[model samples]
Target: MFTGLSAFPLIPTDENGIDEQAFVGLVARLAAAGVASIGALGSTGGYAYLSREQRALTAREAVAAAGTTPVIVGIGALRTRQVLDHAADAHEAGAAAVLLAPMSYQPLTDDEVFGLYRTVTAETTIPLVVYDNPGTTHVTFSDELHGRIAALPNIGSIKIPGVAAAAAPARIAALRAVIPAHVTIGVSGDWLAAGGLLGGADAWYSVLGGLFPEAALAITRATQASDSTAAREASNRLEPLWALFQRYGSLRVMSAAAETLGLVHSPNLPLPLLGLDPAGRSELEATLLRLGLGA
Candidate 1:
């Protein structure tokens, strides 16, 4: 489940809360596209902003909608107990696995982060993916810390942040040496996925794949077939989208894309988080049309 394209879809929401119909449609689309797994409630899914009830409902809906494709539900929360509760909810929802990011308001120590994983692994029955997204979580996992956590029960895959293309091979090698053989290394950051895969990363936990599975699969399959040129070319084709992600952040840009593509209605993001500005939206729409992704 962890060793291929895992699409992390946005969980569309409005003032009334989760838009189940739109969210289910998104999951079903990924399933039909034959993505190896569907990641629900990940950072792209706006998990951190949702309440427990909303997240649980999203998990259930995603699992139900995904059919045979695996569903990996994110169970990250500020508190350990809350995370455990979310994990249990994911288990009850029939998630194939759970993704855990060490979320923190206060800056966390290496030991504290390790302890968080220890506690969650001790309690949860579902296999957990270590989500190392420092950009949002504010908690970084050193390779040594990852080794420690990977040794814990239920640690199935480690989702690492993006590294430069040149450094990808060595970066993946270093992680491979520390972590156990059974624990797969999944790359986040869509732009880095091709390099990471070519460098020996096992899977792609991709935000872009969630919205455009065929496009992401093009890169993933090309890399899997050992066609580096094709993979790089595929990734290069999306350079404009990656730039937009860098400029406005993936969540905001993707929300706008979803609206532009008519997958969801406007004001799709949770309150306190806004979509892309007019100029950014215009630029994104133009880029999308150039790439043949505009609605």
Candidate 2:
């Protein structure tokens, strides 16, 4: 059901807990920029670092701030039961959908992954989007696995990581051909969005879209209209940002951009995940300026 760009804004926070005011403003900004949906607790939102109460509170506050914008809450956990509980909490918080990733401390088998989704789908009535992000989950969904999960009742969509250069369009086509008619295939990784959108991805579950929705949405609208020239032009404007993503990390770059824009304060990300390097700050600032987003 996610047809175009969906924004995954950072859950702004400091050392103490969620910064409700900053978080609300971030979500409101994305909504105002006209993103298709607001995804709370996504990669940028630091779902793993938060406690149960914090996650629930963030989802609740996000929904309230989003106004009429649809909210998709992330509920990925190592344990299936924990995910179910989070999904229920998201549902109660008035979320429009829930996103699930196969995050594990212990290495997981295909069967374990399958069972996790099966159990979550059985217990949760809210629509679930399978997030096939091997970068974070350390578990990749095989072609067969993608089809199986998509067919499950209420499995509304799958957000796939963008593939290699040559594989995008064909891979998207293959995934679409196999997944149930009701299941949408979304693409993540901002750099891969151009090829994925041109290739027929149903949605762009985007990090950049959260920071600058109008720019990202311009690409979405252009791609949807099959205006390859415009799409490439918009995407070209992001070359510096994409390079930062490749060199530093999406979280680091996004946090830096958000802070530079005065959209939110530099968030206190979870342990082990550090802030954007001071060494790279000037470079990022230059990129931001070139993109016409004043630093």
Candidate number with greatest TM-score: 1
Off by over 4 Å in 1: none
Colliding pairs, model 2: none
Q: Per-residue CA lDDT of candidate 1, range 1-295, in tens?
A: 9898999999988778988899999999999999999999999999998999999999999999999999999999999999999999999999999999999999999999999999999998889999999988888888999999999998999999987778999999999999889999999888889999999999999999999999999999999999999999999999999999998999898899999999898889989899998999999999999999885
lDDT tens readout by residue for model 2, 24-62: 999999888888899999998989889889999999999
Return the lDDT, model 2, position 217: 94
Question: Which candidate gets the maximum lDDT versus the true structure?
Answer: 1
- In order, how many clashes per candidate? 0, 0
Those runs of model 2 whose alpha carbons end farther than 4 Å from true positions after fitting are none
lDDT of 1 at 10: 91
For residue 1, model 2's alpha carbon misses the true position, in angstroms, by 3.9
